[model samples]
Target: MTTTTTARPRHDAPAQRARRGSTARRETWGSAALLLLPAVALLLVLRIIPTFAALSEAVPLGSERSPWSNFAYIFSDPSFWNAVRVTLIFSIIVNPLQIALALALAVLLTKRIPAVGLWRTLILLPIAVPQAVSAIIWLVLLRPDGPLNGIATSLGLPTVPWLTDPTWALASIIIVCSWVGVGYWMTFLVTGIKEIPLSLYEASALDGAGSWRQFWSITLPGLRRPLLFVLVADTVSNFLVFAPVRILTRGGPQGGTDLLMYNISERAYTLGDTQAASAATLVLVLIVVAVVTVQFRLLPGRED
Candidate 1:
């Protein structure tokens, strides 16, 4: 004889399922937080701590000076003002010039040219060269009696003072920086150019759009994010340029090339003004921040 047995529901209740999902999410978040803890701790130790320390030391607690004496000293110093001017001039001149040149070079390299790979490699050769070495090479070429002037004299052209004259010294530095920088910036832009869908360009071409029109319509719009990144990074790099100034110019030619970074270094090392130098660094950070903020507003934002 068999007795009828009552059947139990095989599925969990909605509340039970919800509780299980909640528990799973909590565990996942806990594990993720645990994994991120070390990285966050390292960042705090390496960056945040040093930054706060510098800021605090800039206006330290002492009878030696007022609270903002360090900042005031730097702000009032003519040398610091000259550094600001030189740095601003360098950034304004070089950033656009470098980006424009890089874009042109990227387009050229992307075109169908014989031995294009070799040309790209040669252009990128400077990336492998140390900045100091590059600066020294340029220094040798630009020296008064160097090969450049010698060649100019042989050609019956007047010898131009490449590095000695204040008028041309900063421009010389810009040329050196641009030569070294364009290839590196082009690599980024070329990668961006490659990422655009070929169909877009093909369709534009089929529609009778010229290269200039297509560049403005398709290429520029497609490259908004990359261009913004390049602009910001290049701006920061130009503002912080120090090695070439240090190696080749040494901020000389009547202080025509005294960039902010070099000035800070000189103050910190030569004059032993760490506090004032820290103030200068903070000022530089503020300038860069302001510039980047403006750029973000002006440039097209990320893809929606």
Candidate 2:
């Protein structure tokens, strides 16, 4: 009887303490969710809603009102396919080339070259200039009577139609795009390179590895994650390229530089065909998704 009485004396104490702890955790989480709601709501309204709306417009149902006809229209048009091809070609050429050049430049900058800070600044200067402005500047530079042609003429070479000629129009677009983008992309590579542990390089040197060998054996392997990140980011950015095309080429010299984004913009704004534009956007999104999915799948241990 005495033992039972003693044990019953403090039964409410444990329950009370547990209730207080639970209440404290609930308040903490409630405050955190309240703080996060605004950002979550903004993203939903701006990004998620518009994406779904665009998808809806792309899908033509029946009586030509369905998304099927819209998709059919996009797929059936030879011009659309041409634009797609051009876009893919542009992305494939520019992204890899820029990445290679950027990596090279970043490595050079990292090597304590003379006036290194100055050189880095000069390389990044183009990024500070607006893309539209850069395109316009290059438009003048590449013109028949401009600096490039002048230089060629001084060297006893024939003047070339850099922008107007169909043969050179796409190439010019790619060059201009790379010029504007390479510096920006280089910054990312530089950051990734700087993050590598110095000990790895020292160890590689101790193993009698030359600079090139060290880069291949240690640097490249260390950069796998950053390289993947940059690759995906650059791919997406290159796929959406429109500024240079819009300002300098306008998808011209017989649409040689017509990218998918330019086509969508033309349909939506110039042609006032929102539905068609939305369909084009949906198609572009699908292509991007497919590319990214394939990339991640091929990457080791990336599934998680």
Candidate 3:
């Protein structure tokens, strides 16, 4: 009698639920696509299209020399090699210097310090000024007769040739790049640091961990993703450095500051060798991709 009283199942319930879920998923995907359309379109137009155009221009066509001639020419040129060397050296020095300074400032500013906002504003102020304007300003500052040398003279210190001597010219470019980049990188680190839970620090203190120990264990691990991002972005930015080199050095006191981008621009604009410039562009892109790939592999926390 009890078994006989058992009602038949509502067979359509599960199907109805499935239909509802499918509809919801479709709506969610549609919304996401709508949200992403503008950015995707912009990237396609600005970046993807131009990169393909450059690639087409890079390859030699009918009635031209060998398909690899442009690349061969650049590879054979001493100036191109010098630009590569200078770019590598600049990257080796500037990336670490900027990240270290930015991390230090991030840590210091995130502490309970008075007038921290004012300090941050002052640091970030340089980013608001255009890089070209910044180059012009530093052009004046680094000149032999400018205020920097005037101060050095007042202090009885040797007046340095910041932008004229080859070694000093590269160093001056590094300085300018770092001054602009450090604050920008610091903002990212500061945001990362704030996202770290206060409970972790408190727990570490309770466990008798010193400031340095806490930083090593907690802060650095928290910063892995942010640091990786900064590393890649900073590397790319440094590689594409052209304005400062063009404005300040014009590829050098002995080609010392001729970064790859400046070299490419010089080939295209100055010498009217668009083919060589396009080939160099491909090389620059490849180098950036390789460097960034290595950075991603080395840094932990990809899951984040």
Candidate 4:
């Protein structure tokens, strides 16, 4: 009888503890939502709303107006196709080269070397410079009478036109773009490499696996996810490349460096044809989405 009375007195204890746990959970979730709300709101205002508005402008509202008319204008225009071709060529040439250079630099940096911090800082320094500034610097360096051609003349080598010639203008832009982008991409690879478990490397070493073999088996496999992410992001950014073309070449030397963005801007602002520009913009977006979809479908995910 005494033990039963004592057990009955503890009934409120369980209820109080449950209430405290529920309150703690509620507070944690509420705090998380509070922290996330600002960023979510900013994205909605800046990106989501503008994107939808642009799309609406691109497509017609009633049967009297159809987006096809605008699209037809874009498709029939030779310059539009030329710009598309140029953009595709630029992306094709630069993307693989950039990835290769970044991967090589990442591997080299990961090795046991002196002054690693200094090397990393130097590599990353380009990213700190504004894109416009970098383009201007390249423009100066590549000018006909600039340092590059001057060196060529001094060496008694025929001076190759770096930017003025149509043949060389797009190539020059690609070179500058790759130079500016490699460091940023390499940093991602470096981070991914660092995340690989050291135990795997140790085991491979114990098995007398050479550096190349170890990298192919362990490092490459570990880097797959980061590599995919970088490829997707780089592809998207490269497709929309505008700064270098605008500043260095102005899509000049016979429009050899004209990209989709440059073309769209010319239509929207310079030519005063907002509707056509909006339609072109929508098409560009579709192309990027398709490319990304294809990439993901081809790569999917890590096998093991």
Candidate 5:
């Protein structure tokens, strides 16, 4: 018996193409995940595992529940509280100073100034130097009889008690940190500034905006996202700063520069109090998170 044969519609081609396209996307995703696996594994192993380990040490995780004595001890300790204040103040002052200076440099370098390229290279030299090295150099410069004091003596200016006094010690650390960090941060600002369309500036200028007005209306608004990132990241970085304090004042003449990281190290090593150290470290982490969250709330919207 002859059966009537019907041809398949041309819509079959589109269905087959759709299937191939889906398959291709799956392959692409598979390849991407394969490429990302190593980084994810390393981060989990190095960062996440150690973080949890520290948290466990601080909070006590065993067959039986333990009292939160670690947290209690750290919270009650006056030095730990002082460290908290010093850390917050350091971040408060240094982050703004660094951002302002970096933003200024970013704007300045974008202009047609003589030897501007060389100036940028010079400014970045401190960033290339290791933080430890930079700290040591500042230690030399700021010591009682160092070049800075010597110059002051020659010029008959009052020399700063940079390291010996509690008041000046923290300020000295902030100055050193800003010196090393501002140029590094300026690079980010420069990238953000460059990403801003020149057309915006031109349109503003045509509408009778002067340089200051343009900066406020155009440049500042355009840079909101970068400023937010810089603000948050800088605050975190400054909070965790340790090496400069360790090298310069060892957490102080009187705990003036007793920042959270330095305080944690002192607890861990000098006092042989690992539990307290872990607790303090966790507190530091919490403070950073809280401050950053506040910054996100306070700053201009990221989407804009």
Candidate 6:
């Protein structure tokens, strides 16, 4: 008797709810657009504009006789071809070397070891240092009379030329690059390894699987995506290597370390050939695109 009649359900409740949802969606879309605007604007200003500008500079607009003069100049130059060869060799060596070392370090550090955090921090310290600064530090260390040579001398080993001989110069550059890259790539693999469930490892252990067996079966499969990312990024960065080449080698020791980027810079700044530089820049971009495309096709992903 005391219970009042329940209020009649609002007839327009669903309609009101639909209107609220629509408003919320509109707000969400507006917020997303606002957040994306800055990034879009910067991309246009920095990347797109510069690419088009380089294109414009590369082509000889005034001459119908040779529209491809800049490209022809680049192709005919021995320096350009040398740069291309060096770049390819560098990619072939550095990409696999860095990834392999990184994988090894990642597996080692992920184990329950003493001072693991300290070890990781020390490895990653190179990344925190700017590339130019890192290059300078390496420059000192690699000098003929520097600490590295001194150590070799103390061990009664001949002090080999680190940056003064052609082959040794290229190797020195590779060493510097790997030193910087290994830790950075290792961090990514570590993150990938940690994502794997602990139960899987325990199950493998219970099944009498050794550490090597578990790594091959579980760790490698789990790391496919991360490995792909590291490979592509490492390839691109190695192709674009200029700082160390500039500060340390200067594409010297008989042009053995003349990477395409340093070659392009020499053309642009040192030699005052912007047209050839632009053409070389476009070539570099095309090479990167082609290599990355091949990587995407060849490498298996998580979905695969």
Q: Please, what is the TM-score per model?
A: 0.87, 0.84, 0.90, 0.85, 0.86, 0.86
Whole-model alpha-carbon lDDT for candidate 6? 0.92
Tell me the whole-model lDDT of each prediction, alpha carbons only: 0.89, 0.84, 0.90, 0.88, 0.87, 0.92
Badly placed stretches (over 4 Å) of model 4 are 1-41, 302-304
**Which candidate achieves the best lDDT against the true structure?**
6
lDDT of 1 at 8: 43
4 or 5, which is superior by lDDT?
4
Q: In model 5, where is the ten-residue run with the lowest total lDDT?
A: 1-10
Instruction: Tell me how far the alpha carbon of residue 256 in candidate 4 is from the true structure, in angstroms, after superposition.
Output: 1.0
The C-alpha RMSD in Å for every predicted model, in order, reads 6.8, 7.1, 6.2, 6.5, 6.4, 6.3
As a TM-score, model 1 comes out at 0.87
Checking candidate 2 for backbone clashes, the offending pairs are 59-67, 60-66, 60-67, 60-68, 61-66, 61-67
- Which regions of candidate 5 fall more than 4 Å away from where they truly are? 1-39, 63-65
Give the per-residue Cα lDDT of candidate 2 at 186: 81
Candidate 4 lDDT over 178-256, as tens digits, reads 8889999999999999999999999999999999999899999999899998899999999988888889888888988
What is the full ranking by TM-score, best candidate first? Answer: 3, 1, 6, 5, 4, 2
- The per-prediction tally of clashing pairs is 0, 6, 0, 0, 0, 0
> Model 2 — which ten-residue stretch has the worst lDDT?
1-10
Q: Quote the positional error of residue 49 for candidate 6 in Å.
A: 2.1
Candidate topping TM-score? 3
Q: Write the per-residue lDDT of candidate 3 for residues 190-260, one digit (tens) a residue.
A: 99999999999999999999999988999999888888888888888888998889899998899999999
| lDDT ranking, high to low | 6, 3, 1, 4, 5, 2
